[model samples]
Every structure is written in C-alpha cells, then in structure tokens.
Target: MDGQICCMVMRVNLDCNSCCRKMRRNILNMKEIEKHLIEKQQNRVSVCGRFKPADVAIKLRKKMNRRVEILEIEELPVHYEAEQEAPIVNHYKYY
Candidate 1:
C-alpha cells in the first residue's frame, strides 16, 4: 500500500438554494459521526472539509465523551456534481 492515506466524506444532498439551517445540520452530523468512528476504530485521521464552523467542532471536542483530542481541522472545499433535474415538467400527469 502507498504511504498516503484515504479519507471519506459524508454524502450530503443539497442544492445551491438549500437553506442555511439544513446545511449546518448536515455538516455537524458529519463531523460527529467521523469522530465517533475514529475513536471506535482507533484510526489516525485528519478531517478537512469546507463549510464547517470552528465553534461547532471545538464544542464537540470539549465534550470528551467520544473524543479527547481535537482532530486536525482544516478548510477544504468539497465539490461534486449534484443530481440533475428535468428542465421542464409535464403537467398532464398531475390531472
């Protein structure tokens, strides 16, 4: 195996117009889940992702229940193609 390590990103379904509240909730959940896995599996990992608030991470680490060390935090933008939608919809089926 190569010396480099691989990391996984939680899948979040959202569009450009998604509400801020929803986005925040998804990000928080991602971090919490990843942290739990790190503790359970005892794997060394560093989490770097965009759109995550520092305060939320700090608060979660403070709990010290599942994690005692603050996992490495870095800001990196996550980009992927969102599911496409039909440009137009037919109303005949609605009747």
Candidate 2:
C-alpha cells in the first residue's frame, strides 16, 4: 500500500477569451505528465473545468491509450455583484 500520490496539476488564470487557449495548453501538458511515467510508478494529470471542455477527457484517454483516473470535480461559487469598498479613514480614536 503505497501512500505516495504522483500527479500533475495544471492551473490556469482564466479571463474572458483565454479559456480556449488555456484548454489547448493544458492538453499539451498532458504529454509532460506522461514523461514522468516510469517503471511501475503511476502518473496522473489534473485539470480544472475551465481547462476541459465537453468530451475532452474522453479524447485524452483515447489518445493516450492508457488508464486515467478522474478525481472528484469540485464546483465553485459565482459572485454576481460585489460592494464597493468604503473610504479608509485613519484616526487616533484612543488619543
């Protein structure tokens, strides 16, 4: 029972139009993870939802022709509107 976890995480800072570009870049990083696969050790890849579109995982698995483990997908919250910060007032209250 080896407790070591061997995996690669691809993190992308998302903006408006960068989603598509990040996805393509993340796909290429999969090959980098594959390079770490040696002997009996297992190498895995982790990608966020923004990096993966529909059916991308399926395509990656078929392309790699190897077993890929999908971990739990976490859903993040969306904040529609945020309140503006109040003006900062500095004073010696206890003076």
How far residue 8's Cα lies from its native spot in candidate 1, in Å, is 11
Q: Global CA lDDT of candidate 2, please?
A: 0.39
- RMSD (Å) of each candidate, 1 decimal: 12.8, 14.4
TM-score of 2: 0.34
lDDT by residue for model 1 (1-95), tens: 11222233322222333333433444357643333222223333234333244444454444322342443543322232122222566668654
Error of 1 at 49 (Å): 5.7
Q: Assess every candidate by TM-score.
A: 0.26, 0.34
